[model samples]
Target: MKTIALLVVLTVVAADIEFYKTANDNYDIKALIANATELQAFLDCFQDRAPCSELTASYKKNIPEAVVQACKKCNPSQKHMFRQFLEGVKKVVPKEYNEFRQKFDPENKYFDALEKELSKF
Candidate 1:
């Protein structure tokens, strides 16, 4: 019971921090999945075997841990499909947006951080 409560408190605090940091919609789980969809597609394009073909399909069938974390941070209704166009623009955008090109994705910061933090759980 105590462990569960601690987890909850940690989650709330994390959410608050994200909200304060982003000052934008805290991406929900589905949105995280959407982001994964984008990632899968990109990977598929780069790899000779086409990672997107497998990655996107896998996400549609089974949600990833990153997606679940995103869902926890934001509301369910906020979920949206990931767009390749937005991702493309991110490449040319200023470094501030890229945050040292962390993960080579600007919008993925939340999902990335969530995945890292949740790994311990």
Candidate 2:
């Protein structure tokens, strides 16, 4: 019982240990934007849309935060758009449930690197 309790305590503490590179609450995001831009470019290319640049910029500006009142209202493209948005938080965020998303296949490696890089925002 003591061991289990200790393990639980450690797990909780570990989750709170913000690695220096990945700390957002302690670090400023504006400084991270340069790194964030690279991932955005790659995604913009993958999505192969001209407006991807503008959409990404709007997302960076937090326009969606005002627009997306509910989770379900988030559409497929919006999720796609968000995967691009979370580039700064990728390292901290867990992988998604989608089997197709769980591993790198086709553009998966690229997208994984892309997501990993994106989460730096």
Candidate 3:
């Protein structure tokens, strides 16, 4: 019985660690994508062209690791929202998207694999 209880606890802990903390999950990604001004702000923030909001800063901090890991820590909604945001950026502002790619993926290492994996989500 003690062994079973320990196994259960470990399983729960492992599950919790499998994804990133969800605090920012409720942020309105769709709205940000739809509003050109807001979208530009996010791009500017990430590209170091402007100051970042607390939330944007937090996201910028995690973005590289998230991309390298193929968003393994993202929950389903986050995965979907990220895909939506990427598609929106690439479609709406190709130049800025290229700039973003250059900034974040300077060596051209991660984005292709990340996008391929994200497409599966």
Model 1 collision count: 6
Model 3 TM: 0.79
RMSD of each: 13.4, 14.4, 4.0
TM-score (all chains, Cα) for each model: 0.23, 0.23, 0.79
lDDT of 1: 0.40
User: Alpha-carbon error at 31 in model 2, in Å?
Assistant: 21
Give lDDT per model, in order.
0.40, 0.40, 0.82
Among these predictions, the greatest TM-score belongs to 3
In model 2, which runs have C-alpha deviations exceeding 4 angstroms? 1-37, 40-55, 61-73, 84-88, 92-121
Provide the lDDT at 93 for model 1.
36
Please, what are the lDDT tens digits per residue for candidate 2 over residues 1-121?
A: 9999999999997677432111122323334434655544533433443344543454433322322322223333444444543443354322321322333233333444444433333
lDDT of 1 by residue, 3-104 (tens): 999999999887774311122233343343356555444444433235345434433322232344553533322232222222433443344224423433
lDDT at 13 for candidate 3? Answer: 83
Better of 1 and 3 by lDDT: 3
Per residue, candidate 3 scores C-alpha lDDT tens digits across 1-121 of 9999999999998787666654487678778888999999999998999999987887788677778777877777777777877888999998998988788788989988878878976
Model 2, residue 19: C-alpha shift (Å): 36
- Please give me the total number of clashing residue pairs in predicted model 2: 9
Worst 10 residues of 2 by lDDT: 19-28
